[model samples]
Target: MVPTMMLVADSSRDAHRREALCDLADAVARRGEAPVVSSFGTSDELESAVASVDGPLVVVPAFLAGSDRVSAELLAGLDLDQRFDACATPPLGAVPSIVGSLARRLGQAGWRPGDGVVLAADGAFDQDERQQLTSVARMLSRRVQSPVQVGYLDAWAPSVGDAVERLRRRGQRRVCVASWQLVDGAGHERLRELDATAVTAPLWPAGVVVDTLLSQHRAATARLAA
Candidate 1:
């Protein structure tokens, strides 16, 4: 039997968000060849799941950017050498699929060629992760053929509202917000107050996203097998 592949997602107290992520994991499991599916927001949950699953397992982080505190906890709990077959894959944001999805979502949100855009990410306090978000924003700028500014939901400078206002000050009335989130959460709730012409939905259930995840699983399996 092939080693099972599981994804660890950011856990939420919100029942709706939890259900949605589980649904997405199920959907991915169905679409791909990954045998097992599990998500853990906390280290305790992660340890329990790892103990329950036998044999080799490939753990994939469903996060977009740099690792968060929860992810750190999960990592700290894992003794990879003890379970030599198990390995963690990079975050989903490291792939190009997100960029493709962002462009498509922006188009669907009525974005025009010249429309000013803001890539709103769940900002990280760490400088490296913050740079990662900025890099993605620049990639988006190239894809959209417009200046795509970066906005944070938590820390760092330039909130989404500030980005929209800056664009408006430049006389760009039509501004669209591309949400760089996997699922709607409290951060998304705050996006409601942002003054923008349109805000795209979170990236989920997209063909590109599923394909990217499947590819990550394949890579992990291959690496572990090697």
Candidate 2:
């Protein structure tokens, strides 16, 4: 039997975040794939779905980075009836196409030649996740032909507002925040609250997001088949 595709995300009360996940699941389903969306906080629902599935499961972490921890935590949080064949794909942030998506959002936000760019992320406490975000900023810098600074929304130094202010102090007339979130939420709202000249939308509804998820799902499916 074909493995069910489960897209799991961190718990969030933001309505936009929930809607975006549903939209992503719908998009995947429209492609003739069986996709299910769940969150870590909803353990009962998640366990119910897992129990209902008959075959192997391809678990896709619906996060930009640090998905391995998310996946591990999710499994640990739930008490399943039995052990089932399951595999998780890489996080969305690890996909190379994400850099292009970020660059596109910057262009859409009216970024100019001398505009200072700050890649704003929902801070990760894990050192490896922090490094991954920094790498994303560097990749974005190269893609946009500008130096990109990394900033965190929480639990890290150099907040988004601070990054923007530093650029302002350096004589930059416009400072654009390239949101590094997968969906709009408290973090995106915090970014907009910052004093930056412009804040780009989160990387959702972008073709790359769906494409990357599908690519990961297909790869996991192939691995399971083997």
Candidate 3:
């Protein structure tokens, strides 16, 4: 039997931010028939939700970086015996399809072929997670056939202001910021302070995101079935 997917996210206290996540998950679940679940302040809640779900479970993390405690807890608490099939898909930002989504959004925001682009991500505390952001920036760079700089909001170096300044120093008059964030909240508020040509919206509500989530779910299911 095909396992049903359960998307797990780190809970946010911001009501609007939390609602946006739920809405995005609901949109994706509708396309893939997966149920959405979030880790609210503890791993116990996530584990309980997983236990309550019937049939084989396919867990998908609704985060951009994988080294966080929430991702760790979801992976650690799982017992992949006969019931739970797969867990630990790559984070949403690292997914390749997201590059296209970002590219289109940037273009819509007046990004030209010669304009510089900054891949702006909500900073991660983990070094590995920060490295993943760099990797995503590189991938996006290749996709658009233009140079892309990696910028963080906090907890890391080369902040949004710094990236934009660097791009300006490099003679770029228009620098587009591709938000590597999933939803708008305090993290995004920092991006507004950056003096960029234009800043694209977060990844939420994008069709490509839904496709990427489904692809991750399918790959996990295939791995378990094999």
- Candidate 3 structure quality by residue, lDDT tens digits, 96-153: 7777787788888788898989888766646667677778888888888989988777
59-171 per-residue lDDT for model 2 (tens digits): 77777773234433554465533554777665667456988988889989888877899988767646667778878888888888888988877667698889888888888
Q: Is candidate 1 or candidate 2 better by TM-score?
A: 1
Model 1, span 108-204: residue lDDT tens: 9889999999888766635656677777888888888899988766555687888888999999989999888776666667776777898887788
TM per model? 0.90, 0.87, 0.83
True-vs-predicted CA distance for residue 32, candidate 3, Å: 5.0
Runs off by more than 4 Å, candidate 2: 34-37, 66-84
In candidate 3, the residue pairs with backbone N, CA or C atoms under 3 Å apart (3 or more residues apart, or in different chains) clash, namely none
Query: How does each model score on lDDT?
Result: 0.75, 0.75, 0.72
Instruction: Say which prediction, candidate 1 or candidate 3, comes out ahead on lDDT.
Output: 1
Q: After superposition, how far is residue 110 of candidate 3 from its true place, in Å?
A: 2.1
Instruction: Give candidate 3's whole-model lDDT.
Output: 0.72
With candidate 1 superimposed using the best TM-score fit, by how many Å does residue 101's alpha carbon deviate from the native?
1.1
Give the range of the ten consecutive residues with the poorest summed lDDT in model 3.
Answer: 66-75
